[model samples]
Target: MSDARLANARWPDVKAALESGKPIVAILPCGATEAHGPHLPLGTDVIISESIAAFALPKLEERGIHVLVLPSLAYAPAEYAAGFAGTISISMDAALALVLDIARSLKKQGFAMLALVNSHFDPANVAVLRDASETIVREIGLKVAFPDFTRRKLAEKLTDEFKSGACHAGQFEGSLVLASRPELVDDDARLQLPPNSNSLVAAFAKGAKTFEEAGGPQAYFGTPAGASAEEGVASLDCMSDMIVQAIAAQLEP
Candidate 1:
């Protein structure tokens, strides 16, 4: 295969893949244009989601699944980070519509399934994905596979920091970015930051409306200073497996 990225592939290649007699899967990496603390770049979610797709490509291909990675959906409902600058939060309705439209387009082209590799876990954003996935399967009749890591079964497979529910720009996410896009991380800022133990999950349960209300004044939770590239690579591997397994299950006869 040339490249699994749809943006880089010509139309002829896409057409050929659809005609190939093998299951054709389209991957949409869903992320957000929001703050991720001082050290990590705003596009951290995009980077991680895309990285998961990259890691899963070979595994997916090994199973005779033809894959095409759609250009990442970088904008999402990031209401919690709205207080921070550069955090573009879209409405849940808008996000849902966009995802449905993308799925509709792929369905018309004879795609077997659409796999959503999402790294942004904002509550509203997660809702949008859940709703969109259901709508895609119910209305469009397109097979949709989404590994919602927030669920206990999936969350338990991730890092301890992620399970702590305090992992925003903390060790869990920071480590993923470090492993994939190390150049984007501010080494000085990362090392100078103190640990934040505030659990966003706990705060949300208490009806906290924003990062500030959640006790993340710096828009961070958990221990960022403790993040390591080694842990990041490991996290990606685990996440990639999740994506592959979810898609594989949906493709089952």
Candidate 2:
């Protein structure tokens, strides 16, 4: 295929690639349509996840791997921000089923691998992905690659604000959106959002059910004013490296 993105490629090109017998890896960028504070757009997670996949295209190509970035999955279990406007939270069961079905279709299409690049950190969403990854490999016989940044090893590679757990709509995510879509960011509001140090991770651990219960009444955390496109670019590079490494490991015999 001339383009690495399935969204832009024709069906005939994909059929040709599959018939060539070279290992074809499909990347599914997973995100949530959730609130990201008043300063950022509702599609912040979608933008970040898709950007990571886009960045990974060249790296995967350089390694002689045939890769296609699938259209981004923009809805997930985002109940934590259900109170916010424009946040579409689906059930965990529904999310899991959708991912499983996607994997099954890819397996039947003769694709060698499916790499899921998820940027949304909702606990339920993460659970669905973890389960789907294992199920896809065990049942569908598909090689699955999922770089879950929520885990400590990957989480540490991100920004300090992200590690601090006050990162929902804060500097960490805000920076990513700013890097990819600056026009979507409300600079004036971002500059005025005071830092919210409450830890979403800790709050969730204690049974907090929503953003308000997690001390994020405005549906944001961390220091948004500290965000910058430069930092965002660096973060994207780091995340893309993680995806590349994960796929490389999965491709090993």
Model 1 residue runs over 4 Å out of place are none
Candidate 1, residue 79: lDDT: 88
Q: How accurate is candidate 2 locally (lDDT)?
A: 0.94
lDDT of 2 at 142: 100
Candidate 2 worst ten-residue window by lDDT: 53-62
Once fitted onto the true fold, the runs of candidate 2 whose alpha carbons sit more than 4 angstroms away are none
lDDT of candidate 2 over 97-136, digit per residue (tens): 9999998999999999999999999999999999999999
Question: After TM-score superposition, what is the CA distance of residue 146 in candidate 2 from its true location, in Å?
Answer: 0.7
lDDT of 1 by residue, 17-87 (tens): 89988889999999999999989999999999999999999888888777899999999999899999999
Model 2, TM vs. native? 0.99
Instruction: Report lDDT per candidate.
Output: 0.93, 0.94
RMSD from true fold, candidate 1: 0.7
